[model samples]
Target: MSTSNEPVSFPAGLEGVYVCNTTLSEVEGLEGRLIFNGFNAIDLAETRTFEEVWFVLREGRLPSQSELSTFVSQVEALSHLTLDEYKLVKKLRGGEPMSAFRSSLSAVANGRGFKSWMNRDKAVVAEEIMTLCALTPEIMEVLHTGRKPKLKAGNRGYADRYLWGILGKQPAEADLRALETYLILTVDHGLNASTFSSRVTVSTGADVGAALTAAVGTLSGPLHGGAPGPVLDMFDSIASVANVSNWVAEKMAAGHLFMGFGHRVYRTDDPRSLCLKRVAERQASPRIELAKAAEAEILAALAAKQQAKALAQNVPVRTLRVNVEFWTAVVLEHVGIPRTLFSSTFCASRMIGWGEHIREQIAGNKLYRPRSYYTGSKP
Candidate 1:
């Protein structure tokens, strides 16, 4: 009984809808700002652990000492994968590491106990966070190295323990801290494309696992959250300080968008990138000098080339100023994680925010079926 001629009112630009709202996070896309539980993302990136950030996103506040201990214990307890789960991850490979990770997560969630565990309200959020944080290393290990990794038990920071368990070796404390900061910075960012996709899936009554899986798929697109690796690759190709300007100019001449140069939001510098750059500087890897030089040259070239480019200063440049991507690449590289794993790591961290948004959508009980104005075949 659907009428093709019925005057279907649309929102023109997909503007107003209470599709989802999360108290844990908000993004002012116009201003390029990200906040988590009333705290600026930069503050969390500088001062908090990944677990602390996760606690804030799920429970609405940074955890106290005792709460942090309890949360860490819970997370550590859920870090291990069963024999069958490990086997399954080992079986799913030969493509993009992020894609493999997403597929593994989906398959593991379909295992018998996963559904029951995910459905429990008292521990659902914490459980989901643990699964995401833990499974990432497992999936990465299986895909990149083609080996089953042994779980390590000890008193290490979450990021340290994660990299250690995956790579089967202890990471330097500085590297672990840098990775932790990266995770904290990336944890949540308003209702971004991927987060919205997660909310949409959850609105259909899908469990947290399915919603997170959907979010990962959305993030795999280059336009969304898939640029970090390419950013590093660009830096590598530029190679030295002197070639930076020429390299950028050449890429622009060829009609290629510079990866990690400008952001869709943020008229000013990205605050998160600023904080990350600080971490990168402190880490002080060899690539730091090269990265900084390239960044400076790129900015100079951008300013000279186009007034409207907005590329003279942005998050990526700020990150390069601090050598953020270089340091991240260095640390991750040292830990045996391939460049391809960067996006997967991003997805792993952002899953916390996605889950929070999904819960918000379910609570609001609204379907996000936005209508569009008819612009085709009206016969």
Candidate 2:
């Protein structure tokens, strides 16, 4: 151990670090498992609504029927923007969707103006966070259109409300189920980049708005939340099953990373991808066949590339496989979500997670101030 003031060193990007404990979710990379608050996330995606999973993540257990009803009602009550907030989205309409969402949400959450959420009760802060999560789709709607879009019916749930608002029509029930599944599967995934950013922000006693805003900005980074749209673009470029191999070969020869073919965490098929594949199948999307074919070609290409090269036994090969973005692109596109709004839609679900973690951060309250390795000219 360095007895002096030299900072402790860690792997760049802090890979394999365990920073804190949480009851929110566990991502088992080796097993390709994702558990949310002790429930299997795949099962939740199959059987739950946006409201139910949001409840489970924040409340740490499945709600009783009456409890779920109460929670749904509560979310519904919170699912509105003030008139001024509605007007705010009009001004932000032509801007980038995620940027618009971040700014507008921060504005709404700090309506009383920039008070530290640390001063409030944990329950109140959690409530405010929930209010923001609930309000997000409404804000997204007005951002898409330069006017306040109408809701489908009273408290239709997050996916329903969002699908209708964006498409301006009631989507098929199956489609609604598909989008909800995507939202549930993605709501939390341990201390991912954006979630970590949120916790760090709130750990410093920032307002909940500021914490969530920081998370949105972090998520906007392509390495974090910008794969789905490009995944769709790749499939469109491939055009047909027969084109997949040559297309993949050309791209790989040019040193392009396959957008949806691997993951940083999962060595096997991403469980979220598996779930979304099912959703895409159920939707009968025209794009899924091309995506699957392209994925197979890409995987074979990756494996062949690895086998052709010499490697040490200790070397970790890319686990060439489909990830969540592979089918996320298919399902979201089939469900009528615009390509430009892909990341924004991701943020909508992830809002649940950021809220849950930000609350957890403030409840225990430790500021995040990591020391850096000094490799520059000695001071």
Candidate 3:
């Protein structure tokens, strides 16, 4: 650890920093690709269920038919909230939705009886993982409606349960597939901000509940999981596609974020965004056409700005493109997820990722104590 903050060199925002190695997932930024356990994420999203992908992610192998059935049944059986856990969520009402969701995680994480992260054997952690995965959607229901989630018997899959619980109605299979793709695609993506936070918290021997709640807290930031709702809202403010150029120009000139445009990595298009674009178009999402139109104008505006900057400064320009949040807003809205619940809904998928990382961190634990060089003068 460094005694000083800097005069030290590092990537601004730790942009390309590599922390720990894992057999979990990888993000190929330049190619705009995401891979989970050596499987192309898009392929998994298209062909495999979220449960299957999750099994592969945690075990490093795809499940057999019997194994998958067992996993699904276990998840379904564990989905029910106990009387006390149900009561905990009732107190979570009336805050930022994601904040309430983060608190709701404690209903399992801290409220449920589990030893510290170090003491729990792998079986207990595995159970915690399954329990949290199944429990999240039900908690979201309670958090949102201030009542138990209206879940039905024999849900088609994990996505069906979550969508049915949150929306309080049976979702169509096609809509469930769309939501499944979104969930599987987003379940994990390399060492993202929230995933890293989960690993860090668990590395310190905290329980899964504590670590996941921490992850959700990190995800609640506008810079992370909070952008999707605003992406839909951005379209509402634009009068028409013809007006998009002017709107983009005004926002850029004002030093405002373009809502759903651009990513920290991924110089090319974002793969998840592309998948959701296709899903939105196929679903005939009300916002898809406008999102496409606005995306074009935003890209052109960015190019013009970058070209001017290049001519003036002769420095290499980094490109920014559409990120997952753009079409995620559209498709999730098309599937009946409220704009406000967009970020919380993200937790439904990501809790699995957080659990996986937390388990990994605890297995070969190392305290995450990174160093920084101090820049301030000594007294």
Candidate 4:
């Protein structure tokens, strides 16, 4: 350790560093596991509804049946925007979906006067979370389809309503289950970029909406939530399993980055990828078939190239395998969700996580004030 009074050096990008503790979820990279609260995330994804997972992440235990029903009712009740909020949604309708969502949420936060959620009652925080969740799908649908979101009655639950609003019909059972699984799997991951952004903002005593606004902006970065659409684009460009290997090699040779392969964490497979792989398998689609074959060919080529080059074993390799985005693209496509709305779809589920972590950050209530090392010609 340096004896002098100077800032401690950290790894570039703060990789492998624990900035704060969280009870919401943990990502175990080496073992390729994710745990949400005390439950395995894979189990939760397979067995629980998005509402149930949201409750578990925030409340720290599974809700009883009555509790779940009440929570679902509460979410449904909060799903509709207020008159002014709806007007704001309408005025802000013609833009990128995420941009519209940011504006719409700001209106809700301002109208409700819901600043400083860190110090509010649990009920207030819950409302903030619910409002964000409910408003997101509507904003996305309006922006994507250029029409007001339809609130049809046959939608039985939050996920169903979300799909129905997006697709403008009663969603099939298969679609509903797949979308819910996607939401559950993406709900939280420990200290990811967006979650960290949320925590950082809330640590400064910002309102919940402000914190989530920061997170959405952070997630807008290409390195974060911007890969799913491109993954699908890559699939479209290749267009067939027989062409995947050549296409991957051509892209690699041209120094074009692969969209869905590498991850910052996860020494092994991404468990979310594994979970969504199962979801994709259940949905019969030509895209799924091409993706499965493409994944195999791509992984094999990447592995072979890595072995031939023989880089240092300790260095991080770009050979990191398929992440959640690979299968996520296929699964969402199979479920009839468009590529344009993919990142917004991710944000919709992640609102629950952002809220939970924001609450956690402020409950302990330490402002994030990390030190920095400056190297450029310091005065």
Better of 2 and 4 by TM-score: 2
Best by lDDT: 3
| Model 2, backbone clash pairs (residues 3+ apart or across chains), number | 0
Which runs of model 2 end up more than 4 angstroms from their true locations?
Answer: 1-9, 310-317
The model with the greater lDDT, 3 or 4, is: 3
- TM-score of each model, paired residue for residue: 0.84, 0.95, 0.95, 0.92
Over 4 Å off, model 3: 1-6, 375-379
Clashing pairs for model 4 are none
Candidate 4 lowest-lDDT run of ten: 310-319
Q: Cα deviation in Å at residue 78, candidate 1?
A: 1.4
In candidate 1, what residue range of length 10 has the lowest lDDT sum?
315-324
- In angstroms, the error of model 1 at 26 is 2.6
Cα TM-score of candidate 1:
0.84
Whichever of 2 and 4 has more lDDT, that candidate is 2
Model 1 per-residue lDDT tens digits across residues 62-147: 89999999888877776666788878888998788778888988887777234522235735654664576566665666666677
In candidate 3 the C-alpha lDDT for residue 273 amounts to 91
Worst 10 residues of 3 by lDDT: 1-10
Which model is ahead, 2 or 3, in terms of lDDT? Answer: 3
Q: In candidate 1, how many Å is residue 376 off?
A: 4.0
Candidate 2, 1-379: lDDT as tens digits: 5656666677879899888789899999889999998899999889888888888887778889999999888888888888887887677666678888888888887774756875566777777788888888889989887777685675368888888888888888888888999989999999999999999888888888899999999998899979999998888788888888789889989978888777888888789998898888888898877877887778888887765563645565655678898889999999899999999999999999999988777777778887775655657
lDDT of 1 at 341: 76
